[model samples]
Target: MSGIFKKIESLVEKGKEAHAKTWHNWAGNIVLEPELIFHPKSLNDLQEIVKKAKKHGKKIRCVSEGHSWSTLSVTKDYLVIVRDMHQIQVEKSEKYGWTITAEAGATIKQMDDKLRQHKPPLSFDSMTVLSSVRASGIVATGSHGAKCAGASISDQVVKLQIVTGDGELHVFSDENDPKEMSAARINLGLLGIMYKITWHVQPLFKLRMIDFQPPIKSWLYPATLKEFVEKSDSVEVFYWPFNESELDRNDDKLWVKQWLRTDDPITTSQAELGMERVCEDLETRFGDKLYQFIVKCPESTPYITNLLWKAGPVSKPQNVVIPAPDAIHYQSGIDNILCDDLEFTFKADKDFANVAEEFNHIVDSVYAYAKKGKFPMNLAAEMRILKASPSLLASGYDEDPNAIYCFIEVLAIRHTSGFEEFSAELATRWMKKYKARPHWAKAWEHVPGIKPYLREILGKRLETFESVRVKYDADKIFFDNKSLEEVFYGSPKSTFTESHL
Candidate 1:
């Protein structure tokens, strides 16, 4: 499309990955064809690409593992795949304590494997359920685990190296500049292309994972759920509609998973864990086949979900002590089944009175809609309890570290009828009732009135992020996506100026 591609090709070891081939996201929901794509090997390669792009007035966007469900990583200009920059190192610093430093492209699994193999073993304070995502991308989207005392993954970032739109490398850390660090913690790739990252880690610990199916009416309330969360290091709740009874419409049971840090010896050895994974992989394959059939017959979702629950492990009870990493990443093989997810996070007060009501409302809404012959939600409604984060734009942002927050999401198989409308309805209600904020990396672009609502609620915080963003990329070279532009710049249209190289 332009001669600048020739100039940029001379700067990198590999000319380009693709010229104009179509690219799709992990879910195949968003697709685009960039004029040029590159997998730079080192910092110099990234710097050279950035400089050439800036000179040619082309925008740049870095993609991680392509797991994002939103358009945050979408760009038709210059796309960068950071897989080549994966290099991880474990460093012990007096000021920052023990940290795992790695290039921005390092996947969570790579880091987890390295930490587990260390002399004394090491692990992050919090981790996402999936380990295939890149570290930098995880932090940018504020992904998190269910640890009650732990915040989002972004909170664990101690240092970062980025190449700004000016084509200069800059390093920022909490020790040097907390204000700037706040912005860099979860900048959504607007500030620059992250080159490397340093994450806080701790001595590897064990967790006793226990699962129980309690009656929904008994432990699903605010007070009891509060006790459950307060007593556990990490807690997650899942409810599959029609799990208990389809005809009676009595989904009276809830599958609750809790993890508590313990001194107990590891009950599952590395070999055993590997074996378990193999078995689970087989199960996932079988489940995927069933899902394919259900996808063809969408109306059988409720019946199939009920059958799966009755036959699944959640129908029984189990407990085991395992390494923290193993427990944190509980399930795997999700890439086979594509789903649409909409997630939101809101602060829970000391007693969690409001959060409890809001959660109950979610369940009630599902049933209410179902009664009218609408089955917008067939998958599990998942919720996690996490501590607050200090990142300015994080969904769970709060001043107090001890503050409890609830991150809830509803998922549906891709192409499920009425999913978009259902999500929009819930998003609007949550925003108005609980002042909830949607997860940056999940589905939210189609939600009506979302842009104005975010602007109104995140007025000052958006300004703070914008101030720092301008300092790094004054010309807005990284602000090419319409979804992010709608939130920060109050524009729902692309401002990219096309120029032939």
Candidate 2:
């Protein structure tokens, strides 16, 4: 520590109390024990910690709720908790619509609750199902909602207040250096710490949930698939897996949730989304006896996939109208199911770009792995469409000029044997075939050649990210983990110091 920053030790000790302990993300994925943890209540306090970290040659990271699935926020040297910096401001303008300014520590749930109090009420465009994540974290990792127009959380951020490595406060917006702004929109927590965020919110809206069951045999009818996406504001397709013999009987089915904004004033929905409600709709769709059997023998999942898609009191509510948030988010079911997922975006060949072919390929991949004795996927493969973004490193952006992007993800329960291998194999194939970029907020460390892949696909965009990264964090104080350095900077694992020292 003595060879690092000269006055860092003293500066860190000045503004806040520090502790040493082990920390893990909300998903229990990354667990690391840092040398020191500081709780910063104000901007000045955070500045002092950053100054100290720079002076002492200590790596630093900031965590509020630690909801990230990636290891982006883990640090072995120092960690700053900015949870106490939660503050929010609201403003209205006819041109930009409603703008909400909130500190990095603010949560989506908190913002959503506050936005609902507006005259017309306001809601964010894209959001994760779980509302507990910090607002800045959402943008930092490029989290996306099921909506097509908004794309990802970064799309909603209009401005950012950042504290760089030099302990200086800088504000960024689209009007200021559009390239840097694009890079900063999805910071990856590398450029700097997000102190505050300003988001462009939409007026209060209601969404009608339509639960429709499409037979597995014809779910991907070309015309029907096009209408499914074009008619709905947001669409989520739950492709349920089934046994081979069931395909012979043509009993398999796909469950679909199509959400569209409505002016309707009614709110009566059934089959809340989560494992707790697993049987809430299933039991009614099929007889209780069969439902119980599928529950017990998960391998028999195909028998009930269609029944759940059948309109009923559960997900198939006829005319349910709920607030934007209710219709936008559903339970993640993470609490009950110890699951892991492999999510990536890609544009299929033009001739095979439709959902049916995509699903066929996905099914083919699953069966390929299954034939090789890879473990069967437990939960249904969750699929969603994403729009392209101008952000430099936006993973969902289609690299091809006219190509469209869609997110394909598969969940494997922790209890399942070979869960890790199964996911890794699938991710490997997706990246190899599609040149996919793994989601920043998910378990993506194992993706093959992800670093070189990103470097190749991103091309100059990677350079732009590095240039801005160095501009904001020249000393690399934010490079908390060796994995990030290895991937982003092509640093050798043996020595983290190549240029700084």
Candidate 3:
């Protein structure tokens, strides 16, 4: 062991300090070897980690599952893993109704299971499709579901607790400070290491998911798209691009997944969605080999994608009614298929004119690039409609009560050649055309001049976030990454020594 490793081991208890091993994100894209890594278990342990980092003049960053594609969790000095703070408490208040207070490290699946077993049963209003992620991590990164009436996951946060860089525990709630709550809701880990988060939940509900295939020309029209979104409680669209010759029909089709609130009894044995499909078996058996081939050949992507689509759930129309948790998290084992993803969220007009126009533009652009012998995207292009969020830094944030947000993303298998250039070009186009904001947790750092663009586009919100951020972390311990500094402060700067503790 090196001198640094020996010193780090001496600082923490035996099992708490991780050996100086390199850490990588789920997609294996970003890798870092911090000077020291600690898995603190309790609130006191979190505070102690912060205090020690301050004493050693080392910067600190917290991570949970490392699902983010961005460098927000990067820290060369100290990396704190909060996963051991797993605790769950569900309570009902006369004023607050149903609320669940979960520790930062608790997984969404854990919360869902506990809520399902609750006396009355409860669940989140909106959530991401993957239940394996940490609840607080998803909330901090502004993850969202397809609920047209529901906002991003952060909007469900009613109270938050964190240990700031000063080694002091602070709590923010609407009852105490709404402004701070807004900033803390989707903090991007700049403020501090969050230890506990409380969210307002709802009684469990059932939903019927109707999957169908419709011709692209008719289904994606602005007016028609608006009708489907408005009619369903949640709508998700997936398009796997293909060359005209590969399709059996003249025009390609879209797979539309619509979820509606249902009073019908729930399916007693709800199998994981898409698990029973034959395509899933093929994917599990040959996904890696196929992905490797696509990465090497690149040109074979279209044909393989088309075949996968035919064998996928969309190939046949079907309907199933399941409880809210199952419906919200429809798919499983997605993280197993590593990929590079970039998502954008922008305001949509009531008629969805902009949504229709931009989505079609993207579809056309994909084929256009392929014709030029460039395959930047080979996987599904997904879109979801959601209501506005109150979190200041959230991509879906807006003041209008009726405001709607269009969430769309382009994905390519990880390490694909020309993918970065392709995604950057398309991202730039979307930014210029619709003032689209990229999801903070996804890939956007590579986009040309992303920092300045975000600074300019998110002017007032950035200013508000900076103000609240300094109150908790005046020394900038958590603000330790280049990407965040460039976007938030316009450039990299040194940390101030004044302590709030």
How many clashes in each candidate?
A: 1, 2, 0
Query: Which candidate number maximizes TM-score?
Result: 1
Alpha-carbon error at 162 in model 2, in Å?
A: 0.7
TM-score of 2: 0.83
Backbone clash pairs for candidate 1 read 3-501
Which tens-of-lDDT digit does each residue in 120-165 have in candidate 2? 7888876787777788777888888887555678877888989999
The TM-scores of all predictions, comma-separated, are 0.93, 0.83, 0.93
Model 3: lowest-lDDT 10 consecutive positions:
492-501
Tell how far residue 241 is off in model 2, in angstroms: 3.1
Residues 1-501, model 3: lDDT tens digits: 699888876655546778767888898999999988898889888888888888888999878988889888898998988888889999998878999999999999989988989989888887888877897789889988899999988888888998887899999888888899899999888878898999999999999988988888767898899888989999998877773345333377888899999999765454445454334545545766676788889889888877767766555566888888888887655766789999988899788998887778778877788878887887768999999887899898888867998998888888988888877777777777667889999999998877877888888888888999888888888878998887877744322112200
Model 2: lDDT to the true structure:
0.70
What local distance difference test score does each model get? 0.82, 0.70, 0.83
Q: What does the lDDT read for residue 389 in candidate 3?
A: 87
Residue 383, candidate 3: Cα error in Å is 0.6
